[model samples]
Structure formats: C-alpha cells, structure tokens
Target: MIGQILINGLLNGFVYALVAVGLSLTWGVMDIVNFAHGEFLLWGMYAAFWIWSLVGLDPLISLPIIVVLIFALGVLTYLIVIRRVLKVSGLTALLATFGLSMVLKNLTQFFWTANYKNITNPLVSNKSFKVLGMYIRQDYVVAAVGALLLTMLVMAFMNKTKTGVAIKATSMNKQAAQLMGIDTSRIYAITFGLSGACVGAAAALMASFTPIYPEACALYSTLAFVIVALGGFGNIKGALYAGLIIGVAEALGGYLIGTSYKYLVVFLIYLIVIQIRPRGLFGW
Candidate 1:
C-alpha cells in the first residue's frame, strides 16, 4: 500500500510540477499572472490528438507540433494582448488573462463540445513492472520520466544559457536588470512563450495518461493555482515541493476518505499551509 501510494503520488505530482513550472516562470520574470495558461495546455492536447488521429503519428512523436502550435499562440498573444497589459496594474493584467481564459474555454467547448477524447495508447493498460512490491504502471512511469527530462532541460536552460540568465535576472529584479541593459520586454515575451511550451508538453503527456475533455484544462487551471500557491509564487523549486505534497495528500486522502471528498481535502490542506505561510511553503 505504501509503495502504491508513493508511485501514484509521484506520477501525479510530476504532471502538476510540469504544468506549474510555466506558471512559476511567468510569475517570476514577467509578474504577469496568466489565468489563461492552462488553455494553452488544452490547445496542446487537442493539437496532439488531431495530429495523431488525422496523420497517424504516434502521440509522443507529435510533441514538437504540440509545442510549436501552443508556443506560437503564446507569442502572438504576448505581442498583441499581453504587451498592452504589461504596463498596467497587476489587477488589470489578471483581468485581461481571465478574459482570455474564458474565451479559450468557451471556444474549445464550441468547437469540440464537452465530450472526452483520448489518445489510445496501449502502454498504459498493457505494460507494468513490479517496483518494490508495487505494480507500477508503465504509462505513468513514462509520464514521470518525461516530466523529469523536461524539468531538467528547463532548469539547465535557465541555469546555463545567456537567455536563461537574463530571464532569471528579470525574475529576481526586473528594474535592476533593466537598468543593466537587459531588454525587459524581450525577456517577458520569451518567458511567456517558453512557459506556454512547457505547459504544452505537459498537456501532450497528460493526454496520454487520461481522456481529453474541453473542461479538463479548466480543472488543471485550478490545480495550477494551488500548486503555485503551495510551492510559493514565482518559485519553481517550491512548486516542485508543493506538487509532491499535494499529490501525496490527495492520494492518501482519496484512499481514506473516498475520491468524492478528495478536492476538499486538498483545499483544506492548502488553506492550512497558507495560514502557516501566506506566501507559500517556499516563497522567494
């Protein structure tokens, strides 16, 4: 039971971390909270689904397309809409994004309806391995491994590259960095696009784990907010910790209290944690 719980928590946490990393990155550098972030993930899911279903490509193989499509959408929005919001107050920016979220959610429903769609990957149901006396699902393992690779790559990119350094500088102190000659606007745009790409990859992988639905991304949006809050606003490392904690809490709570009340348990714990630390467990 213990091993099973750990495995489940880790995989679920992996997805949560992947999705929230983008949010953290954007919040860190741009200070523009994007309520529309998950919609980009949802777009990626549909992108992967359509690519696979129409072109007969494997879901994994279509990841690039998913990333590109969502990245382009993000960049376009940055140039057209978010650019205007950058100079506005945080509340205005938040409202701008909230409007975007509503548009994307409703647009998806209009086109796709609320029916669930999935990429029929057999590895999920067909393959598994016993790990420390627990039968671990191969698909979840794939998701975990994929999430790890993506996270590592993002971290490495942020740590070693000049562009990455600029992003961090902006995140840490935008005004100081701007005075130092860094193009703050460029950094903001790059951050948005990259964050979108991260969530896009997450969405593609998430589709492999479960059925895709229009409202699924909407659900993930709330989860993303909880993750960012639990992890600490604008802190990727904190997001990681928060994701694992929430994942384990949910797993254990579902086991003990039934899945129906699972969300209540998550929120209650989140509230308790926030009370103890308003910024988050690892707010910078």
Candidate 2:
C-alpha cells in the first residue's frame, strides 16, 4: 500500500520535474528566470493537439514537432526580447518575462478560448502494467521513462560532451568562459532552446493526466515556481529530488487532508526552505 503511493507520487512528480528542469536549465545557464516557461508548455500542448487531430499522430509521437516549434520560439525570444535584457538585474529580467507571460496567456486564450481541451489515444486509457502494486498506466509509464531518459541524456551531455562542457562553463562563469574562446552568446541561445524543447515533452506528458485549458499555463507556471523554490534554484538534481518530494507531499496531502489544501503544504515548505536557505539545497 505504501509502495503504491510512493510509485504513484514519483510518476506524477517526474512530470513536475521535467517542467522544473527546463526552467532551471535557463536559470542555471544564463541567470534567466523565464516566467514564460509554463506558457511555452501550454502552447506545446495545443500544438500537440492540432497535430494529433489533423494528422492522426499520437500526442506522444508528435512530440518532436512540438519540441522543434517551441525550441525555435525560445531561440527567437532570446534573440528578439531577452538578449537586450540579459545584462540587467534579475528583477528587471523577471519583469520582462512576466509581461511576456501575460502576452502569451492572452494570446492563447484569444485564439483557443477558455474552454477545456483533452486528447484521446490508446496509451492514455490502456491498462498497462503493475509495478509494486501500483497500476502503471501506459501514459504514466511513457512519461516517466521519457523524463528519465531525457534527464540522463542532458546530464550525460553536460558531463561528457564538448558543447555541453561549454554550456556548463558558461553557466558557471560567463566572463571567464568567454575569454576561453567559448561562444557565450551561442551557448545561451542553445540552452534556452533546449529548455523549450524539454517544455514540449512536459506538455505531452501533462496531456495524459490533465485537460488543457487556458489557465493551465498559469497554473503550471505557479506549480513550476513552487517546485523550483522547493528544490532550490539553479539546481537540476535538486529539482528532480524536489519534484518527488512535492509530488509525495501533494499526494499524501490530498489523500489525508483535502485536495484543496495540497498546495498549502507544498508552498509552506517552499517558504520555509527559501527563508532558511535562499540558495537552495543544491544551488551553486
């Protein structure tokens, strides 16, 4: 019984982690907190919906298209809006992002309306597998596995590859790295684009569990903020760990208390953590 809750929590948490890590990648690399991150995820879900509807591609399978589109969007945003603001203080950057967030949100609502939306597929409804007595639906399984694989891939790239090394270098010390012949500008562009690509995957995973609504962009935006705060800013590993923690907390809170009070506990923890150690558990 306990194991089932844990597994269920973990699967849910991986989705949150994917979202947080994408946000953190930008923050860690460029000190940019993209308030528009969740909106990117929202748009990707819509993108997946259309592709699936028109071409009969499953949302899972249409992931590449969603990713490419969002990635391009991220790159364009960097070049057009974010590039000029990068040198300012964090508050200024956040203000720009917040404005962008509102713009994207209103744009989505304008085009799509505020009605609820969902996608159907075999994997989402299919009876899949049982792991540790937890009913592992196919969508959950695929999302978890995808999240894990991507996390490992990013970690491996950062740990072993040349460009990845450059990214890490830029993240840690931009000026020193620029002196070493690394194209800091290009690194920032790729980092934001990669983060946006990850947001696409997050959107696809979210479609399996929840309806896509205009408010989803803001709701998940707050959730991502909570997870990032809970886990610690600019800490990918911490975000992963924090996701499971928040997921478990939310699951247990909903089960033991009420669903309405779930975020209370999540945010309470966030406040405590941020108050005591603002840098975060793993923040560097």
Best by lDDT: 1
- Score every model by TM-score: 0.94, 0.92
List, residue by residue over 145-237, the lDDT tens digit for candidate 1: 887788778888888999999998988888999999999889888888888888888877777766788777776778878988888887777
Angstrom error at residue 240, model 2: 1.0
Write one digit per residue (lDDT tens) for candidate 2, span 135-159: 7667777888888777667777777
Lowest-lDDT window of 10 residues in candidate 1? 118-127
Best by TM-score: 1
List residue ranges in candidate 2 displaced over 4 A: 1-3, 126-133
**Candidate 1, residue 259: CA error in Å?**
2.1
Clashing pairs in 1: none
Could you tell me the TM-score of candidate 2?
0.92
